[model samples]
Every structure is written in C-alpha cells, then in structure tokens.
Target: MPINTRRSARISVIGLRGIPDVLGGIETHCENLYPALIRDNPDLDITIFVRKSHTVTITNEYKGVKIRAVAAPQIFGVDALLHSLWCLLICAFSTRPDIVHIHGIGPAFFTPLARMLGLKTIITHHAQDYLRPKWGWKGRLFLRWGERMAALFANHIICVSAALERDFLKIYPSAARKTHIIRNAPSSIAGRQKPDNDVLKRLNLTPGRYILAAGRLEATKNYLFLMDAFKRAGLDDMKLVIAGTFVDSRPDYEEKLKKQVSENIILPGYQQSEKLTQLYKNAALFVHPSHMEGYGLVIAEALAAGLPVIASNLPVHREFLLPEKCLFDPDTINELVSMLKRPDYSYFLHPVAISAQKNDHWHRAGKEHMRIYRNLLPNSAILTPTTR
Candidate 1:
C-alpha cells in the first residue's frame, strides 16, 4: 500500500514505555493504532519514542510502520515523566516530525516545547490524573498545572471518551472547539479463538465461575472496594480474579487488599494476551470498578468477549455500556452485588455490542488521527507524491 497523498505527512508518537505492549493502556493504544495508520497511508512516516530498557524488538517495519528507540533509564519512580522529557528533547532535534502526537499527561508537559519547534502538537488527555488517589497534594497541584498548560498549548487535544471531553470542557471551556473525542478501541483479540486449557492450568485457575477484573493494582482501580462489595454481597460461589502487575506506589494498599480479600479471591498478577483471553472467555462476569477512566477499554474487551459487565457508575462507563448491560454506582455495593446475582442475559452480549466496538477500533482511531493530521498540514504538502 502506497501512502495516500491526501492523508498524512510524518507523525511521531510520544509516551507509553514503547509498544508490543509489555503493559498499560497507552502502550496498547500505540501498538494498535500505529500499524493501522501505516496501512491507511503507506508513505506517512511514523516513529514511536521508546525507553532503551524496553526489550521488545521493533523490526524495521511492521506492515510499514517504524519504531525509534532512545536511551533513557526508566527509574523506579520518575520513569514516565523523565522518559517523556527525554522523548520531547529527542523528537524536537532528531525526528522533527510534522505532527507530534503525545499520549497522556506525562508527555503533555512537553507539548509546548514541541510547538515551539514548529511541530503541530496533539495531546491525548487519557485521564484525569490529578484526581487519582496516589498523587499527593503537591503532585496533584503539579498535575493540575500540567493539564491546564497542555490544554492551552497543544494545537489540538484528543479526548479518548466523551466523559473526558466533558471534564476538559469544565476547565478549558474556550478550548473546547479544539478538542476531539475519539474513544479507545477494543483489543484486536475480540473475535479470536479462546486459549487452550493449559493457560488456565498454568495460572492455577480451575474451571469455576469467577468475576474477572484486569488493570494495574493501583488505588484508583478500587479493587479493595470491589472485594469488600463482593464479600458484603455474599458472593461465595464466584471467585474474584484480579489480573495486573503491582505498582510500587501502593505496596501497603496491595497488602491491605490481600489481607482483606476472601479465600476465593485470586491474584494471578499480570497475564499475557493469550492467557488473559482464556480468563475472559471462561469468566462468568467481567467487572471494572475503577474510580475514573478517560475511556474504559477493558469494558469494551469484556463486552467483546460476550461477558456481562459491572462497572463504576462513572460517566465514562455509561458512555459505552448500554443500560441493560451495565450496573453503575460506586457508592452502593449492594447494587453491584444485586447486578452480579442476576442471570447472564445472552442478548446483552450480542454481535451488535461487538460490532459497536468497531467505532473505536484502532484502525478507525488511526484514520481519525490522520484526518486531524491532514487538517493541520499545509495544503501544498498534502499533494506531494511519495515512494511506497
């Protein structure tokens, strides 16, 4: 596929520890979107900034996409922010991309610098980081300042969900016109075959009814609350399986959850895609009890897996999950319990829900990004021919 002259020029993505996603949302987004963007415009050069320590090998091209690695020691605590700063400096001098797409608040702080270097800056406001429980007062203050500055400085701001757009509008009302709401896509594994039983055996999970929750073991995920709610609801038959890596920021919080949870609760930690898919398929229900999400990708994943969902009553969850499919309300544990007790309605997990997921699929997300890139590029540049 040759690059479409009318689509894009050169785009550089910053943020995420780099792709082939060893972990996290932004990385997954990049892995999915970049390849699709390349498919859409073959000549549209894409470079992803990655940490040196990331062991994922990036071949010269994956369906005509490129990956660029930079040397940056991802320290235990300050890795994300530090890596962003390193990427900003590197991108500014080396790549000189026509469009610089920065993911999350960590990279948004560098938008102004990219703009100063004559790059068209686009920032994706992934979530309300300031509101997260892990950030202290000072950290929160810094995040607030960063969010405001990034919103004001970026040429365009992309909101992953409508809920995020609403939050952005509340603070940066005047810049609302510059904002774009492009929801996060479901994982590409949506319709893929379920993994073998060996995967479950490796995780020491027996074939039993269970509720699955997958995300970082952080405070904002509110797994502790979910555990308490499950206990209070007297859900003895169904075990709770939490799948995600532990973040050091909340070691005590993890310990607290472990101490409080019932014997049925299973912390299998982080399971790769094949194993995760097996878990999703085998589970009786999928629950996302996060305090906040810019876009609930896991909700979409659960829906795609044809599983009923019980999510936080947050606006983001409501934006995607249909009323019948979702039970929202963070305050009422009893309500969640009640929802969980209901029989699984197969109709709620129809193909329509899976098809609805295409709206946010990485291919569409990449095309939407290309549209933004075209809008920002010089008309003359759009007409230039390029090699396949």
Candidate 2:
C-alpha cells in the first residue's frame, strides 16, 4: 500500500446499489454518511462500490468520496452475492483498501474471503435481512449463513439501532463482543432547506389535504393494508399519496396495488431530495406501515419535518417512544381506518421522537465510524479493545 501525502487509510464500501438518488434505506445511509466522513477527515481516501446496473452516472466522485461502479447483474437474490465477491476480488488485486466495510447481511457473506486475503472487514448489520418477506427459504438460508459468516469473520460489526443489535446478538451471541450500535440518523434539520414543490403542484396535491407514505412498495411495508384502510376510512376529499418505487423481487406487487388505487391515491415512485422533503413537510399525516425495519429512519425524517406520523406497531416504531394512538395494528383494517379518520393530529407533537434530527447525528455517526476505522487499523490508537 502506497502512502499518500496526508491520508493514512483507504476504505472500500460495498453492498448498496448506486446512491445519491438510489431507492433503498442502505443507499440513503451511505449517501449521507460517507460524504460527512470525507468532509470531516480530509485525509481519508474512501471508495464506494456501486452496482453498474443501478448507477446512472459515469462520474468517479461524489462529494470528495471516490465512487467506483462495479458490474453487477440485475437479478434479485444473486446480484448481492456476485457483487460482493467481485468487490472482494477487486480489493485483493486492484484497489487494495486497508479496510472493506460491507453493508447488509447479504453482502457480509464474503467477509471471510476478505479476511483470508489479509483485508480487515467491518460489517454494518443494517437489518435482519433474513426476516424480510421478499426472500424465499433458500434466500433466507443464504442470508442467515451470511450473518454467521459476518459474526465469525468480520473484525468489527456496526448495527444501526440498539434493537437491531439486540436481535443480531440473539442469533450470534458470541459476536456480541465485537458488535457496536452506531445508529442511523434522520436527514439533518438544524435549519430546514427550502422545499421543492414542483411534483406536488403537478400532482394537484394541496398542502394538508393528503396523507403521505414513503418507502418501497414491498410486503413488509404493508402498502395494501394502508390502501385498504384509506378506502375504508372514506374521509371526504382527503387523498392518499404513497411516494415510493416498487421492489424488484415483487413485480406483481405493483399490479396488485394498482387494482386497489382510486383517483385520489397517488403512487409517485421513488421521491428524494427537495421533492421528498416537500411531500414530508406538507402532508396532513405521514404514515409508515413497515412491519420490519432496521431503524425506521423515514419515521424520524417525518418527525423532523414537523409532520405527524402514524406507523405500524413494530418494535422500531415503539423505539421512537410514540404515543399509543399513533400506532395501529396492520392486521386490523378497522383500527387503521379509525386512525385515518382522526380530525386533529396535534397530539403527535412530541420532541422525543424528533431528537435524531435536532442533533447533527450524521456528524456524530461519521465520527463514531472513523473511531472504529482507526481502531481497526494496524498499530493505530483510537479506542481500547472491545470487552466480551
């Protein structure tokens, strides 16, 4: 490894499909986090590995961080496995990063190979990917195996939320010694950026007259439940806007959802940046019906935008300390419809849930990540050894 004038380490990040406007939670996390990292530590040379199928740009850089797009096939269950292997091979022969940070359990399967090639590995346990409904038995088994590989091989593991850390430790109890909760923050809201309402105006949506939900149209998100509830609620002239794209694994999900939507229900696929912020800030209520989430970052973002949020009764939602009334059981259409019918939403004005945004948490996340990176480096002094 050749030393640069000031930089001490080179880190390679993998597992998310391209970023800066990509659709997944992991993509958003990387988009916000890596930039903050290089901004704070000018000497760190970070190269992110993005899937060629998902990347839109030919550029090699993003906000001081080097972007290396790798060729990955556009298959659902196999893409991650192949992409990670390709990246690890590249790390071994080409770029030679001091550390390879693998995001998500699916990609963490290659951690052992990375270690075998003398590369330090850090795996961020974004979620219990095995538990997601998108995967079949084979996929589930593979993801679980990936978790085991990560537990046994990675030098350090970072879990996004404490609940997620708890869940992962339960499965791989011995891995607890090296695992740490670094947390995922909502987009910064120290002072709000001006909203872009171009899409809103085009869609004929008026502020406070619509209910907004944002996330991929997956079974775990329970979009069908939300749509059914909205129809049953039948609040006159109040529209429902679901601002997200479809999941690749669930192509039929779009057709199923389309059959149920009326003129008032909007499906503006994959909103981000100013458009997403506009939707968040202007909605009468922001709802997240996800049955499983690593850290309900979308809920936190809604809270940050000063929007009232109603969510499914997931542990992650409860982790936000939201009041009972704001959460509803997804199985019971009546309960959700009742929530939709509530005339006044001012009861949701609590600061406890919005704390992630109030604090510049992305900056904190970047610092914590740097500490872990430094501690793992050869002969580096940053933190003491982890206790079992």
Candidate 3:
C-alpha cells in the first residue's frame, strides 16, 4: 500500500479466457496478479478486458479492477486472436489506457496496433503455445508471428518463467534488451481454504488414497502419459484423479484419453470450488507430466498445499521444485513409473515444497509489476477517484 507518485497510470489488461478462477494458467495468473496490484497500489487504474464467452454475467468489476467484456468466438484458433483484436480496438478508441499490458502470444499480435494508437505496450509470454500439440501448422505460424510482433513492437516483454525468456531470445535476439523474467505468483487463497471431506465423499474417494493430475485434458498436457505411468506402477489401491475439462478444441484426443484411462481413473472435469481445494489438500501425491509450460502453477499450488509433487523434468519445473526429488523425464514412461512406485513422498516435503510456498506470493509479483510500470512511466502518478 505504497504510493510512488502523484500521477496515476491508466492500464488496460488484455488477453485471457477470463478471470475469477477460470480453468487455465493465464486466467489464474490474472486472477492472482491484478487483484494484488489493485490492493497495493491505489494510484494505479487497472482495467481488464475479458472474453464475453467465458462468463455468464455482465459484471463491471472484480476486486477493484474494472472488467470490460468483449465478444469472442467460443472456438479455439479464432477465439484468442479475435478477442484480442476487439480488446485492442476498445483500448484504442474508448479506454485509451496509458499502458496496454497484453498477456500471452496470441494477443501480443496486436502490440503494434496498441503502439500505433499512442498507447504504451507490454506483453507477457506465459507459454509458447506453438510448441503445444493442440496447435496445427497455421496456428503455430500465427503464434510465431505473435512472438515476432511482440518482440518488435511492445515497450517491454515479461516472461513468466526463465525458460520462456531463453526460448523467446533464441528466436528474437533483438528482444533480449527489452525482455524481462517475472515468474507467476500464487494467490493467498492457496492453502487458506478450509479442508472439506464432503468433496471426497461425493466423489467416492478416500482421503490420501489418490494421485492428482490437474490441467486441461489436452495432448500437450500429456495427461495420458501420467495415466500410462500410473498403470505401469500398478498401485491398484491408489486411484488417479484427472481434474480438468476438455475444451472441445481437442475432441478426438479427449475421447481417446477417456477410452484409455482405467477403472480407478477419475475425470471430474474443471473444478474451482472446495472440491478442487480438497483434492489438492488430501492427495497422496501431485503429478504433472506436461510436455511444455511457461510456469507450472498447479505444481506450485500443490507445493503450497504441502502436497508432494512428481513433475516432468522441464527446466520450468526445476526452477521451483528441486531437481533430484521432484522430476522425471516427461517422454519416458519408465522414469515416471519409477517415480510413482517410490513409496516415500517425504523427499518432496522439505526444501522443495517449502521454497515454492515461501516465494510464490502475489504481493511480491505485484510489486515487481509496479516497478516495471514505474520504470516505463517514471513521471506517472496514481489516479484519484475524481479523474473518472
């Protein structure tokens, strides 16, 4: 709650399915990041532009950050681009924000548009979507173009993981000077939810009798890989709970995953309530076998909840979880099976989980963003209510 200046910066945030615990990494990032920014810096005027399809109501604000909804197609490829363009148009014509901070590559395609309209621009590369299996040739190409545009046009680029910063620099060497690394922070709500056994009873699951894997049921998420490892481990008494929904963009993959999973596997779809919280709290272990990530938020969440994590041996995961105790090669079922078969989960409890829980705070992340915004607009001050 510090005021750094007298003039307020009007910031318009774009790119996301939507917020208030939507079922994606970027949504979770926005949900945690913006609220903290608002609570700590009253001088900053923050408005988030959202996709209308993601929500049921026309609410104007959330946790003091204004919300502006724009029509976006529910389909996959078209949704991000079209929604971003619409948000850009509104920022250019109506809101006229001092800083237009766009999240993710798809929306970064509009960075040039924001700059052309005399708005300062910032883009956060949450993940390299082009690397994900869900995207085809055209989608990948467009995302690549988005990276190029963001590198060339944005005033500054923020990467949620150091791995992303390295990956972006490999393709856009010129962006090295402007790009920055700011890892996503966990919300205070991480371990605050009261333990609910009702969730276990309703799902016909017993406490501490299940391994958890939570992410959108997509190919790149590699949920099937986890299933294979679990099957090979042959922990029949221990159930596997896959807690995410298929977005209909990958219907074939979804159907295949459903067919492939065994009797003990649970697909509860997307969960955001006490059930999800309870799942995280009571799980015997948390596993993430994603082929790619900007940052693994769920892994961090699991660590925060004091749940042991067994994740893909990706650099991003290692950045948070200890290399020796928390990872296995994502491509090899044998490595994952070995990890699953290990009887002791205590190795993940100490320094690895404790470190993640300690550092992944929204307040720290908000302050970092404030520093970036301040550096971008050195003379800008906080906006008073009268300015509206």
Candidate 4:
C-alpha cells in the first residue's frame, strides 16, 4: 500500500445488518458513532456496507458517510455469515478502502480473510456472542473460533467495554499489544424535545406511571424474568412497558412471551426517534435485566434521560458507577422485586457521576477513532484532536 497524505483516508465498515432506524446494539452504535466521526474529522471518508434484506434505501449517503448495499440472506445464522463474507469478497476484489472496520465477534471471525486480501482490518468486539443462549454448540464453537481469529489476525482490536478488553487480553495474551478500549456512548434521546405526547396516548400510558425496559425482545434480555419480577413487585397501578422488537429467529420465545402478556404488561414492539425518547422520558423507573452485554447502551441512555435504573450485576453495570443496591443478580427475581417497590429509587443514583465520568462521550469517541485511523494510515491527512 502506498501512503498519500493529500487524500482523505477511506474506512470500510462491516459486521452490522444495517443502520439509521435499525434496532440491534451494533446498529445503534454505528448510527451515532460514524456520523459524529465524519462531523468532527471531515477529511476521513467512511462508507458502511448495509445488508440488502434489512434496508431498501437507494441513496448511497447518510449523514455524509457513503453507503453501499450488499446482498444478504434472511436466515438467522447463515444471514450474518454469508452477508459478511460477501462484503469481504467485494473488499478483496474491488474496493481499495484503507481500513476495513468490522463490528461484533461474529463478523470479526472473518478478519483473517480481510487481512489475507491485503487489507488492514480492525475488529470492534461488541460482546461475547458465545455467551448468548441463542447459539447452539456448533454456533458457540464458531463464535469462539472467530474470537480467536480476530485476536490473532486483525491489525488492531477495539473492545467496547473495559470488561470486554480485560477479559479478551486474558484469553489471548499475545494480542494484548494490538487491542484498545473505545467505549460506546449513550445515544441522544430524540423524544426529549417532541412537541406533543401523542405516542404515550397511543399506548394509553401516563407519565411516571410505567416501568420501562427497552432492548431487542429475546431470551438473552431476560424479559420473562423481568415480567415475573414486575408482577410480584405489586405495582398494580403502574404498567410495565417493554419497548422492543421480537427476534425473527426465535418464534417459541416470542410466542411464550406474548401468551404471558397481560393488560398491565405492554409489549409496544420496536420503537425509535421521538417515540423511543418519549418512552424513556415518561417512565418512572428503568429496568435492565440482561445476562450479557458489551457496554449496555440502553442502560446509559436511561441514565442520560435522568431516569433511575435497576440493572443486572454485570461488570459493565459497575463500570457506569451504578450503586450496588441498584444492581441485582439476573437470576434473583426476589431481589429485583424488592428494588422495584422501593420509594427511594433515585436516592442511590449518582446523577453527578454520569456527567463527571463521560461528558460528550461520542465527541471524544469520534476524536479517538480519528486518532486510531491516523495511526493505521498516517498519510491519509486525518484530523488532529482539537483542544477544549
């Protein structure tokens, strides 16, 4: 590869289904992160390869970043595998992107292919996919193999959480020198400035009269456990609004969840923009009951909305400085129930800590990402970090 300081560095992004209204954690991360990256560092050229099945847009640009739609399957396991491979082949055969940035472990497994094609690769380890219950033995093995390949092959690894980076280095100590931790920031709440509360009216919800839990509706989210805990909490007047979409691959889990939904337990399906922000703003208490997470982006969003949270005792929860009392074991329904009924929900929350820990995290993240891109392709004329 030749170094050319006159031209803007080109970054090719993969490992996500699609963006701009997409639901998953990686989708949300890309939607916020890339736009900010280009906004601050205008010289860098970023292009995301979207899966054709999830998105149908003809436009090739979003928020100044270039977009290229690639063919993708709708099957659960095969979809990600083939779509990612297809994109990699395009990179190998056609595109001359300076760096190929892959998000998530499932996609990261293909990093060796990108490297073999003479492309520089960066893997963003979103979470340990092998830990999720959705994967069978073979799937888990594949994910594990992917993790090892990424750790061994990629030019640099970017872990979303300190916990993720720490655990990764422990498993692949030889890869320590290449891995870095670039935290995922909370998404801005769009509903905060909405003119009307019509979305709440549609759901028949009153402000401060609901318990909110938002994420993809899957078994890994522990929604059933949360439903049971909320039932026993005895908040008869307060409704539990779980705002998320059901998984296409897991019909049995979604079917069982729907059967258990009573009048008080509302499954409003997947929501976004002002609707999602309104859900966050109007809710009394926010609950996150998940078995696994890389950085827990929704938990950060709930806090950013000034809503108190009750989350699982994952190390990522502690990373946010969530008090021990606010953290409950995912398996312990009784403990979550007890916390749910407490009158002093906000007392344990550290509102000051939120700003103190990370103020304008996305802006800083954009700058940090630019720094990384510069390091890899020094001749690309990337922006230098601005002084405060």
Candidate 5:
C-alpha cells in the first residue's frame, strides 16, 4: 500500500524533549518549523510530540497545528538519551504518522525499528556528535557507529551545513545523494527593533559597548578560550556577556574564566525570549569561539540583529559569515585583540548580511522542510529506492 496523497497528509515530528521549555538547537528548530508549516498549508495536519515536562498544552487550534505531550523523564546526562528513546517508542505506537521526522542521532538509533513497523523515517544530522570533546573514547566510538547507522537506515539524512554535508560525503560517500544541506535560520525575533535602555538595566548591564556569546557552558563551545581571548584583547570599557546554563563537564572551567577576566565580564545564566533579544540588540559585536559547530545558528541571529560577528575560523562558521561581516581565526588571540582595539568598528557591519539573514528566516526554513516532507512521501514516488 502507498501513502495517500490526494487527501490532506498527517505529519508527526518526533524526538526532542518537547516545546515551550525545550532548549538548544533542535528544540528551537522544531519550534520555528512547525508554526510556519501551519501558516503556509492550512490543510496539512501537524502533530508535534513533546515531553510531559512541558508546562503548556495547546487545546485550541493555532495556525492549524496540534501538540501532543507524552510522559517521559527529562534528564541531561547519560539519561537524556534514555529519556528520548522512551519518548520515541511511545510516539511510535501512539501517533501513526505518515512521516516520522527524528531530530538527532539519539532518535536515529531507533530508525530501523520505526522502518520495521512500516513507517518512513527522516533523520536530521544536526551536529556531528562524535566530534564533541566531552565524550570519552568509548562514547566517541559509539556515536561514530550511531551516525553511520543513522545514515544507513534513515530514508533521508538532512545536514544543516555544507561542512557537515562534506563530512558525510567523506565518511559515507555512497549516501551522498541522500544528504540534503538545509541551513538553520535565525529566531523569530531576529529582525525586531533593539530593546531600549530600561530593558538593559533590568538585565544588570550598562548601556555601553559589549561583545556577546551565548550557548551552553560545555567544553565543545570553548568558552574559556573565549574569555582568555577577551582578556588578551584588554578592552577596558567593552564587556563580554556570556549566557547559558552550565554543565558538569567543566566544573572549574567557568570559575577559572571568571577569575581571569576583568570585573566587566557578566554571566547572567539562562534568559527568556525578550531578554535574549535585548542582549543581541545591545551588543556591539557577537563572538562565537566554538571549536566545532554543525551550523552556527547564533551567528545567524547576530547577523539578523545587524551586529558585527567574530567567530572561529571553522568551516561551518565560514558557510554563513560573508567576508565583510565575519572575522575568522578565533584561535589567534592577537588577531582578536586587534579586532577589539580598532577604533572605527562600524565597517564590520554589513547590510547585505543582515538582508540575507532576514530572507533565511525560520518561516522559510519551515517551508523548505515541508518541501522535503512532500518529496519523501511514498505516494509522491519522487525518491529513488535505496540499494544498500
């Protein structure tokens, strides 16, 4: 039997902790993608699988989307994978979706099982988990094997950046045709006006020049190095605001960073939508010193805010940052120091980059995803059968 295309199609997106409270890239991606789909095709039925921990429930129809929450543990360490696996199993039976779009490798581990039950599976390889430094040799090996399995089993493998696409080609050359490079977009608040001085005061920051870096406090992010670079630059007036919750991977890394930097350094922890937008607006520049990024979504957000960006010279960062708006080679502290000391910094701002970012908004990203979903449907019969 083939999928019915004449009638409205029902699509379910599995994996992730859920929405509203869910954090990080994949969760945010789902948040943006689902609503846009509803706006574009009102006839399309969308069901988002979320965790029980999510506080809000949508009983009313908003833009033709439905939300369903399943009971599952919400833990971050080793148990995070377990929690997602349980949610996937529950979603498998409860929601008989036409297409099950799994967010990351944690859910891809169960893709074969989903296929065994006669459902089409699409996995987005959001990041190369194997490259993360927190994982030990054994963990790295497991993730490497898991990624290969995901590529082999998933009906379609979505890579967020060209760098990731290139990586897939090298590791799994045969699956290159299955790989799709769809870049992630900025947050919904990207183009909004910068918040006023009152908002900055609430966040405990003076209305002055500052550099911003926001992400989880993990080793892969290389935040400590960011602090060192900022210190070496010796910007007395310009402060560096670091935001996001801390994990235990680097217990003393944060303390050491705080000790080294001048009193100007501010760590405000996690922030909500309005505050986050204000921070982006108030910043003179945004610096991402991460050693690895599948796709630098924050960089996109910075571009959207019309701020100059100085990111690591990683391949993924280069994919988004045009020549005018970006400063590569974050590892070189001296170069970063030079960038900080420049009196005339307005030249770093690029209107073209800002315009490009607005065009690549989340709504557009969701529409692109819908196109992929339509292409993958069995009734469409557009995709070639996999030989492997």
Candidate 6:
C-alpha cells in the first residue's frame, strides 16, 4: 500500500525483536494487531520498527503496514536498550511519526527522548519487568526507572490488563488520567486443516494423551517448577511436552532447567505455526506455571483452542480464566501436580473456552486501540481522494 502522508495520524511502533513469526508476547501481539487496525480504519498509517536481525528475509511492509529495521547489537539485554535509542533518533529525525509507540518498559527508557524531539509518544506497559527473577539488582533498578520515565513522559500509557493499570495508578497517582487498559489478544491464525500426523508420530505422541506447556524457557515462566510437578504428578504413561527455546540472555538458567527433565517429559524447542496449533488442539491439558505476565496470553490461546488449562494463580491469569479450580499456586509444586492428576474436563470446558475465545478476538482489540488513537488525534482521518 502507498504511504498516505495526508492522513493526520502516523503511528510508529517500537520495541520487540521483530514480528510476523517471532515467539515473544509483544511480537505475537503486534503481528496479530496492526493488520486488523489497517483493515478496520481507512485513514490510519502505521509503521513498525524492528531489529535488523529478525527482519532479514522480510520486505519493508507487512499487511499494508510499513516496516523499518533499526540496527541493534546482537548482545542480549543491551540489544533492546540500543535499538530503542536508535529508534528514538530515527523517529525524531526522519520518520516523524505522530505517535511513537514504544512497547515494554526497557524501551520506554527513551520515551522522554522521543517526547523531547517533538514526537507524540505512547508507551505500552507490557509488564513490570523488575518483578521478574531473571534480572539482577542493576537490571531491576533500570527497569523500575524505565517504568517511572514511561509514566512520566509518554503522552498516553496503555496497560495490557486492568491489574497493570491499577498497579501503575497506585505507583504514579498523577498518571491515572493518562493510563488506559487494553488487554492482549490471541493470534488471528486459524487452525490448520488437521493436526499434522507426521509431526505427532515423530514425537511418539497421540491426541489428548500429552500435557502441553509453551513459552520462553526462562525463570519467570517457571518451567523448572512445571517439570518437577509433572514428575511428581505420577502419570507415568502420559507425557509432559514443553515448547519454546531459551533466549540468549539466560543460558545458565536454561541449562539448569534442562538438567531436571525426566524421560516422560518431552522438550520440543520453539514449536510454531502448525506444530504449535496442533499441540494446543490435541493436548489433554495446557499447563502454564508462570510467575508473572502482563497478561497471560498463552492461557487465552489455550482457552481459544478449547484445551483445558491449569495455570498459575496470578491476578492476570484470573482476569481471563473464570474457574478458580484451574489456577494453582505458582510457587507450590504440589498444587500444580494435583491439578495435573484431576480427571479430564475437556467436555465441561469446551463451551466455556469457546465463549472466552469469541470475546478475545483481534478485531475487537484493534478497534479498541483505534479508539485510543482517535481520542488523541480527533481529526486523524479527514478522508479525501488522491490521484497518482
């Protein structure tokens, strides 16, 4: 699609390694979101800034939205910080997007910079990263500072869940007026024709015979606790299948988690597309023992797949999941183990899960987001014809 420079609203997205096929929460959220926004709103011009490494094969556009790759160091934690700084400069100098929307707290450090450069800034508070166990004292302090700066500087702040919105309001009471709640939505990808038989057969698995836990192999995800709980659950024949590989930031923790895996547990690293969908569809139960989440999007996806879920008892998880019985104490291995031992609830849960799925559609989320933008730029869409 040609750039509609006459359109009053020019929103640019930063933060996230990249999109289309990335595995993280923010990446998947953006990949599903912008397409819907472009389809629903005629005069919106959106651009996403991605890391160069992740956009090697991709062109300069995705689903009518512009894609710009900013140079980032290959280093782990520093990559986002550096990319965000570069993005701030790029947005200020050349792109001059009306709203420089930055995702996650780490990147939000540069929100003040974007604002200073005469760019209208919006920061999406994906999570309070300081709370995660992976970060050390300095990293935690930086993230806490980033959160404060984001709240202080951004023209608007969007919290992914009501709980997150409340958390921010509690800390920065002045930000209450600017902060808005916007929950994450699942992928727009429809289920494949059928579960690929070759994929399942190769893994020595059958439909509804295995348990699935999919997410980054990191400390916050608490995959170690899930693995231990699966062993203690005593379902010898029933396998516990884990998806997602370790990111570069946590090699030691990844190896430590791997050391605890038993024979009954299958580690299928980073399953995506057809394989991931099949895992969700066929699993007896979807287990997520995450210590934290801005919003537990995987739980929503599991519910969408009509798979029974057993998740950590986090407030964000509760926000999406109605049944209290499905939640377990994230710190307590016994609780998760007991939930794993319970009788299959697929028949009882199918209808409820499907209902929840219907409400959490990408189109609804996109419309809500567009509403926010419209409120900020009321005259954003003064439609007029142009001849090339």
Best by lDDT: 4
Error of 6 at 322 (Å): 2.6
TM-scores of all models?
Answer: 0.89, 0.93, 0.93, 0.94, 0.87, 0.93
| Candidate 5: worst-modelled 10 consecutive residues by lDDT | 379-388
Error of 6 at 56 (Å): 6.8
* C-alpha RMSD (angstroms) for model 3: 3.2
lDDT of 2: 0.83
How does each model score on lDDT?
0.76, 0.83, 0.83, 0.84, 0.73, 0.81
Number of backbone collisions per candidate? 1, 0, 7, 0, 0, 1
Q: Write the per-residue lDDT of candidate 4 for residues 7-85, one digit (tens) a residue.
A: 6888899988787778889988998899999889787789999888776354689899888888886888889888899
Against the true structure, candidate 4 reaches a TM-score of 0.94
lDDT of 3 by residue, 1-388 (tens): 5443366678989988787767888888998899899899876789988888886456888888988888887776898889889888888898777888999998888888888888899998999988888888998999999989999999999999898899889989999988889887764545664655587887788888899999888888898888888888999889999999886347889788888766698897887745688898888988999999999888878877777788888888888756666778889899889888877766556565557675668888889898888767645454433332
lDDT of 1 by residue, 277-333 (tens): 888888877888888787878888888777766678788887764664465577667
State candidate 5's TM-score: 0.87
lDDT over C-alpha atoms for residue 179 of model 1: 91
Checking candidate 4 for backbone clashes, the offending pairs are none
User: Could you give candidate 5's per-residue lDDT for residues 1-388 as a string of tens digits?
Assistant: 4443344567777776556534577777777777888788776777776666643443434346677766655444445456556656655687666787888765677777778877778889888877887777877776777687778888888889899889877989988777888888887765545544365686566644778898877778878777777777878878888877664355666677557545677777766556778888878888888888888888888888788777788888877746733565756677767777777566677777777886776677777787788876656334333433
Assess the local accuracy of residue 114 in candidate 1 as a C-alpha lDDT between 0 and 100: 80
Error at 137, model 6, angstroms: 1.3
- Residue 347 local lDDT, model 5: 63
TM-score of 1: 0.89
Error of 6 at 17 (Å): 0.5
Off by over 4 Å in 5: 1-7, 53-64, 74-76, 193-198, 247-250, 254-262, 378-388
